[model samples]
Target: MKGRFHEKAPDDIQVFFPNPESEDPMKDEVMWVTVIAHDAASGAFLGILLNAPRHLKDVQEGDNVVFHLPPDAPLPVAVGMGGERLGWPVTAADSLTETVVRGVRHYRQGRFGHNPPGIQACVGTLGHVLEPSPQDAPADLRALGHFVLARCLAEQYETERAIHHFEEVLRLTPEDEYARMGLLAELSVMVHTSPDELKSGTELDWQERYLKQMATALERIKNPHSLELLGVIFSEEEIKNAAESNPERERKLRRIGAGAFRYKVR
Candidate 1:
């Protein structure tokens, strides 16, 4: 009646129970049970739930199944259950800084797609860092926090909020290439999604301003992805003119593009 369930799967274990009256357990009616255990300290009771199975198997009631648990096993940490599993350390001693770092890692790994729970977890973690005045926070932490917040908002299609966060990151760290990249990417989306708005002189001016900013950032950072993005945004004539004026820039762009394509194909 008392037993521990060994975690054979990621979160739960499956156990089959047969009718006590059945002579052969495998051939007769069997009850399937699913056990889910929290990653807590040892000596805790594992959660047991009955499951319905399409086909009956040989298992009998009153059958004693024994499972072993280490007496001093530590509670399992639940930090990396969702997303890209960046292997961040999650413990009782973890600080807000650590949680922010983990959330940033999740955002960078592109793990927020169609995963609301994971997104919510990351948002909660990063929100703690931003609850106080960001101005009082360390510059690096503020930049990182804003970047992660922007990324999470973008994932949820909260465009304006994401843009504000990305701009905050840039304000905190002017040379923050990631923030510039994020801002430009979001602006690009806005341009595509609202052609009528773009036609307005003010919106057009805003687009041009951000595009120039993106070009400047690309020139300084030379990030391959940013370079590719710039190439996509500019016309062939514009790129050719710029390349003619800056041959080295053109060469770097071509080299980065080729390398990116090769790696992607591989």
Candidate 2:
């Protein structure tokens, strides 16, 4: 699945339905779905079951099911339904930038509340751009996509996944302060802090590699929250040295809250 698999006007998907006929209480029947259209009010997709029910009784082929989009999205391309399906040329679509914005919109909408539905849509839409192997996509959109995905993952404590996405954004723009800050913070976790990131044998811990630029990056952002994050890993002296003589920087650094990593540099 290197590129978009569902470009055809009518996309088909596979979803899990319980197999009522199976003796086991937990067996799931794989069903093929025909996506009809987006339902605006509920944020759920309306699809028709293409398979005749084998384990289901109340519904049969052509029955409708309103489903939440799965987290890994672009609606998985499904088979088993006999028909001539079309594929949209990978290059023919030109709304990628706008699509990225749409993803951000969804992310913001779902970023709050105990349960957020929009996050699913956010991941799916941005994931569409990602599968096309984002290397050739617009840099801003690509970085934005990775950044948003990274934030979503980090909040859930999916540390490694979040690190990978944050790295993606930094790769496109090494000067990305926010992404670097994010990557550094994530790498500070107990597992990664003790090991060198295995790439290129740099012999530099991921935290240190990012920290080499910390002062400059912090200067750029000038947000006190950044000082709070760095305070947890770097020693107070190291932070002060990095802050240099800028009166405001010193002021911010002094206000950094207390906390330190297991490997906090003294």
Candidate 2 residue pairs in backbone clash: none
Candidate 1 lowest-lDDT run of ten: 257-266
For each candidate in turn, give its C-alpha RMSD to the true structure in angstroms: 14.3, 15.4
- Evaluate residue 83 in candidate 2 and report its C-alpha lDDT on the 0 to 100 scale: 23
List ranges where model 2 is wrong by over 4 Å. Answer: 1-93, 190-224, 232-266
Best candidate, lDDT: 2
Per-model TM against the reference: 0.47, 0.43
Model 2 poorest ten-residue lDDT run: 257-266
CA lDDT, every prediction? 0.51, 0.56
- Give stretches of model 1 more than 4 Å off: 1-102, 105-110, 128-133, 195-202, 237-266
Query: What digit string (tens of lDDT, one per residue) describes model 1 on residues 29-73?
Result: 323233333335543223322333344322112111222234453
Q: What is the C-alpha lDDT profile of model 2 across 177-253, one tens digit per residue?
A: 77877776665552233335344323244435545545555666555766665655456776567577777755544
